[model samples]
Target: MHVLETERLIVRQLRIEDAEFILELLNEPGFIQNIGDRGVRTVADAEQYILNGPVASYQQNGFGLWMVALKESGEPIGMGGLIKRDILEDVDIGYAFLHRFWGKGYAYEAALAVLHYGRDVIGLKRIVAITAPENPGSIRVLEKIGLRFVKMINLPGYDEESRFFEVDF
Candidate 1:
């Protein structure tokens, strides 16, 4: 189902059929370096990831990372939406796009829409985000979408610290 829409993109739930794209995306060198490897080396693994991660989140939290696609072509270019992590105090927005689709303003557009949805639709009062210290692109997008840098902190199960950003409605 469509979760949010922009002039050029559509955000929606993930399904098992998206395994091929998930497999390719999870293995992208940039994705692994910035977003951490998801161990989705095969389409089957990607399917499980969708089922156990995003799909499960949808059922449990009413939202999760949804697929971001071009409205015109319906091609899955990325994924973006609200995430409720166990370790975080509040919901956070997350997104990742195939490197080929970077520099097109899609991240900012999709993120802004998701932020609004989290606040207006989901009734969330605050949204947070985290990125690797070296991920300037993500940092730029977070700042552009109105999240301010809060601090650098390490979360459990992660080796390195992440730059945290936040916004309140």
Candidate 2:
């Protein structure tokens, strides 16, 4: 079920129908490099990705990445929501957008909405966000949402360096 909606965005569950858009967004050059290589080559693969990733998280954790859509056009722009990360042992806010939507504040808008939902609605005491040290843009979004830098840590199952940010409700 959809949990949150903003003026220009709707935060809802990732459906099988959203696979094609997920493929395109995950394959964006900046998304691949900055958000890690998802290898979402085909719509079928994207469907499985959503099932194994966000959908499973929702089933297990009660919260997961949401499909972010523009209300005016009803176009899926990206995803943003709370995720349970192995390193944090708690939920964290994560987001991604297509390259075409870069510099448009869509990420910020969607993320703020999700953050509030995770805190006030879901009753999460604290949420964390992890990003590559070099991805300043993602870090900025975390900051804009009131997350403060906590530390640098290597994520389990990931060899790359990552920075952790946190916010307490």
Candidate 3:
């Protein structure tokens, strides 16, 4: 089902059929460098990741990471949506696009829409995001979407700290 739409992008739920796209996206160089290796090597692994990650989150939390597709071509360019993490106090927003699709303002556009949906539809009071300290691009997108840098956070299982940002409604 479609979750949200912007002027140029259509955000929707991830289906098992999207495993191929998920596999490709998960292994993209940009995704691995910024989001860490998720160890998804095969289509089956990608399917499992979808079932256990986004699909399950949607069923349990009513929201999770959704697919970011282009409105013109219906091509899956990335994944962006709200994530409810046990490690964080508030729901957070997470988004990533294929390297080829970067620098096109899609990330910021979809992020801005997700913020509005999270605030107006989901009625969330707070949303947060975390990125690697060296990822200037992600930081820029986060800041552009209205999340201000709060501090560096080291979640329980993560070894390295992340530059955390947050925005309150």
Candidate 4:
């Protein structure tokens, strides 16, 4: 995918150099409890995750999670983009950030950019987002980006309950 830039972020494909940041972000308490407990402990494990997850998704599906970076320092701060889920039956926008970046509108900024790209650049007919039913912050981000509530459903690859949201192009 081509690199996309916002005022404060640069959204691009994952690289091997990003392993440390990825591992750090994924192991955060909020990420473990809310997003899932993937347990990426080493740089090698994080590299494998980028290969098996985002890079593989892009090769197979034409889109996947983007590495979100701070524009000024060119440091990776998070990831936010679309993923084709085998169980969800659609391409869904997913995002996660370091705790330090929370409450600063970074999620909203990156998400809105991805949403626009999915519709205008990729020409997808629709896009979806799913969050744990209790994750009010994510739900608010979906709503803030203009996705409407679709329904409650069991999460794919997870045993938890989730609320699905979608927006049609």
TM-score per candidate, chains pooled:
0.99, 0.95, 0.98, 0.96
- Candidates sorted by lDDT, best first: 1, 3, 4, 2
Task: Please provide, for model 4 over 45-121, each residue's C-alpha lDDT reduced to its tens digit, 9 standing for 90 to 100.
Answer: 99999899989988998789989999999888899999888787768999999999899999999999999999888
What's model 3's lDDT at 22?
Answer: 95
Q: Cα deviation in Å at residue 163, candidate 4?
A: 0.7
* Candidate lDDT (C-alpha), each: 0.95, 0.88, 0.93, 0.89
lDDT of 1 by residue, 110-129 (tens): 99999999999999999999
Among these predicted structures, which one has the highest lDDT? 1
Identify the runs in model 3 with alpha carbons over 4 angstroms from their true place. Answer: none
20-101, model 2: which lDDT tens digit per residue?
Answer: 9989988888787778788789999999999999899989988898899888998888888898867678788999998788
Model 1 clashing residue pairs (backbone): none
Q: What is the lDDT of residue 9 in candidate 4?
A: 94
- Over 4 Å off, model 1: none
- lDDT: which is higher, 3 or 4? 3
The TM-score, computed over Cα atoms with residue i paired to residue i, of candidate 4 is 0.96
lDDT for model 2 comes to 0.88
Clashing pairs in 4: none
For candidate 3, write residues 1-169 as lDDT tens digits.
9998999999999999999999999999888888889999999999999999999999998999999999999999999999998899889899989889999999999999999999999999899998887899889999998999999988886668998999988
